[model samples]
Target: MQQDERQRKMKIMEVRMREIELSLSNVKLLLREKVAQLKEQLHKNGKADVLIGNLYDENDVLLEVLEKTKQRHIILEKKNFLLEEKISSLNKIMCDLTPPPSLPYHY
Candidate 1:
């Protein structure tokens, strides 16, 4: 009778071991899926970081070009003002040099 009881206990222990192993396998599968998802997210974030950096660099370049354009515009305005002043002076000189028309004096 004792031998039969021992055999029965052994069978119960084997069944419990199989259940534990199946549970462990399920846990491992879930962990693998979670890890894969995390890796994909990291990859996407890295790409976004690079794109944002490029855009920032482009913006900086555009700002520099705008500043240069503004400076050129200011310089051109100064030159235009000087040329206008010179033209006015030349016109006055031309008028002074020209003789007026001779007309008869009438009381």
Candidate 2:
């Protein structure tokens, strides 16, 4: 009985392995088909091939520019905030230094 049970378990494992291998093969085939389709499309439109090839580089450059712009924006915002605070402080000092208006005496 124990031997029979072991054989049954072995068969189940074998079947599972085969299913996994078949799934993998199917995925590989689909990927190959997709690549072939893309190649065909590229062949039909030769100009698109260059664009597709350079797209990654172009995207990288654009991303770098965006990052630099963001950094500059942050710096400008901080400077603006500091300037506002300084202006507020100067206004307070001016108000403090001013003398009060004298009242007119009765004629």
Candidate 3:
């Protein structure tokens, strides 16, 4: 009877050990899946970071171009003003140099 009891206990212990091993395997699988998901998220975030950096660089370049264009516009305006002044002075000189018409001589 004691031998039978011992055998039964051994069988029960074996069954329990198998259940524990299955539980551990399931936990390991879940951990692996979670790690994969985290890695995917990290990769996507890295791409976004690079894209954001590129956009910032583009914005800085555009700002520099705009500043240069504004400077050129200002210089052109000053040149136009000087040219207009010169033209006005030339017109006055030309008017002063012209002679008036004279009356016809009497017989």
Candidate 4:
């Protein structure tokens, strides 16, 4: 009876060891899959970051151009105002120099 019991316990231990080995192999396979997914995600994120950086640079350049255009517009507006004033003054002088039409006398 003692020998039979020892033999049964040894058989159970061997089965358990096989099960543990299978579980370890499954875990290793899962870890390898997860590592591959993470690497792919990292590569995609790097490309997105570079594109965003380029857009930011372009936006900065556009802003600078807009500012310069706004300044030039302001300068032109000021010059136009001065020209209008001069034209108005010249018109007044021309009106003063012209003689008024005489009215017809009623009998």
Task: Report lDDT (CA) for all predictions.
Answer: 0.97, 0.95, 0.97, 0.98
Give lDDT tens digits, candidate 4, residues 1-107. Answer: 99999999999999999999999999999999999999999999999999999999999999999999999999999999999999999999999998887798899
TM for every model, in the order presented, reads: 0.61, 0.53, 0.59, 0.81
Clashes of each: 0, 0, 0, 0
**Overall local distance difference test of candidate 2:** 0.95
Candidate 3 lDDT over residue span 2-59, tens digit each: 9999999999999999999999999999999999999999999999999999999999
Question: What would the TM-score be for candidate 2 when compared with the true structure?
Answer: 0.53
Compared with the true structure, model 3 gives a TM-score of 0.59
RMSD, every candidate, angstroms: 4.5, 14.8, 4.9, 2.1
What is the model-wide C-alpha lDDT for candidate 3?
0.97
Please state the error at residue 71 of candidate 1 in Å.
0.9
The best candidate by lDDT is 4
Among the numbered candidates, top TM-score falls to 4
Q: On TM-score, who's better, 1 or 4?
A: 4
The residue-by-residue lDDT of candidate 2 on 1-107, one tens digit each, is 99999999999999999999999999999999999999998787887777877998899999999999999999999999999999999999998998877788899
Residue 77 Cα positional deviation in candidate 1, in Å, after optimal superposition: 0.8
> Would you list the rank order by TM-score, best first?
4, 1, 3, 2
